[model samples]
Target: MGESEQKVAKEPTEETAEVTGATVATEVSALPAEAPAVLPKTPPKGSKSYELIFLVDAALPKEELDALIAKVQGIIEQREGIVENVRVSDVRRLAYEIKKRTHGVYVVVNFFLLPSQIAELERLLRLDERVLRHMVICTRSS
Candidate 1:
């Protein structure tokens, strides 16, 4: 040991992890770098959330129902959202007679939709007088 001897030590203040891209710094006894944080969990587009169910009038003929369903499917597709499932319950009976027909067709569809697009769908259904009654229900969230 003499005047020519020298020692080097790391000062521990705060060091950030470059890999994580975060402003927060971490303390370590050695290199003292924070561990890279993993990406926040995000629900996939096909998540079971955003469950939506809409009931269409059964008064319209089978062809009309098919057409409307196709159009609606297109709209939903354009939104880039996945359709989990669709159920159509066209019960051949109505609370009252419709168009002098004692039996009315009932249709039920379940699909996901954006909040903004809901208004547009409602408008479309309203334009069609053939629908006796319609109901829209959201079952889940994403």
Candidate 2:
């Protein structure tokens, strides 16, 4: 063949197998044309239960604290979530001072919301100055 002319070989089918000095032929079909379907890794898009715990500056007055909690609740409500229960603890000393304060108010909240809305809720909490720390946990059904 010329330098510009290249040889192209076709793929071997299952019917043929090459031996050291002979050729053998059999009959079988090629590999499957498509892969099997796979299910989604997460549950379907819908309301899932969650728990939220947050710490706020202890020195703030009750009115300020209420407003702060309301802001969080509003975020959840805006995303079509229901705030089931809220528990606020009296000011207590922290293991270490935060934002130059020795005490903080601990708040626990249980709610139901779509999984897609959790990130936005966290972003709002992270941006609030009064909120010192926060954690969100998905609660599995019993």
Candidate 3:
């Protein structure tokens, strides 16, 4: 091998057991390609308020949609937001199909978030492909 051509080595750790920051490759030649893992999350803890409504794939079961709703609710709670209510309005035909589906499930999540925390919540939603449509509007005092 030329002086310019050299092999590089990497150190391993318990998390992924690989080089750089990537998980080490486990030999399973027969297995199909692995799906990407979701990134680590840091949640907030405390009191806050906001309202978020989103549309999910109606084809999914009540449990499945509920599971995802729970996940989002957890994130909100972690970030100091309090979950007030979660309403799941299952599969309704859209005036027209969205993302090629003629129907979708609706979810309304009422919560309280710190004024500064809205951006974080929005970012999480943007990253999740499950949401077909979403809106977060600040509430006025009653």
Candidate-wise lDDT, in order:
0.56, 0.78, 0.69
What TM-score do all the candidates reach, one by one? Answer: 0.51, 0.66, 0.62
Tens digit per residue, CA lDDT, model 1, 70-142:
6766766676555555546545665676556676545555566666666676777667666555666666766
* Candidate 2 C-alpha error for residue 41, in Å: 28
**Candidate 2 global CA lDDT score:** 0.78
List model 2 lDDT by residue over 21-117, tens digit each.
Answer: 1244554434443647665334335788899999988888777887887888889888878887788887799999888989998988888888889
Evaluated at residue 86, the lDDT of candidate 2 is 84
Model 2 compared with the native: what TM-score?
A: 0.66
Give the residue spans of candidate 1 off by over 4 A.
Answer: 1-60, 98-101
Ten-residue region with minimum lDDT total, candidate 1: 16-25
Candidate 3 lDDT over 1-142, as tens digits, reads 7896544544434454211223454543232245466664322344344678888887776567767887888988786667766776646889987788789877788777676778888888878888888898876432
Residue 109: error of model 3 in Å? Answer: 0.7
The pairs that clash in candidate 3 are 43-78, 44-78, 44-79, 44-80, 48-112, 48-113, 49-112, 49-113, 50-111, 50-112
List ranges where model 2 is wrong by over 4 Å.
1-45
Better of 1 and 2 by lDDT: 2
Query: Which model, 1 or 3, shows the larger TM-score?
Result: 3
| TM-score between model 1 and native | 0.51
Q: Judged by lDDT, which candidate is best?
A: 2
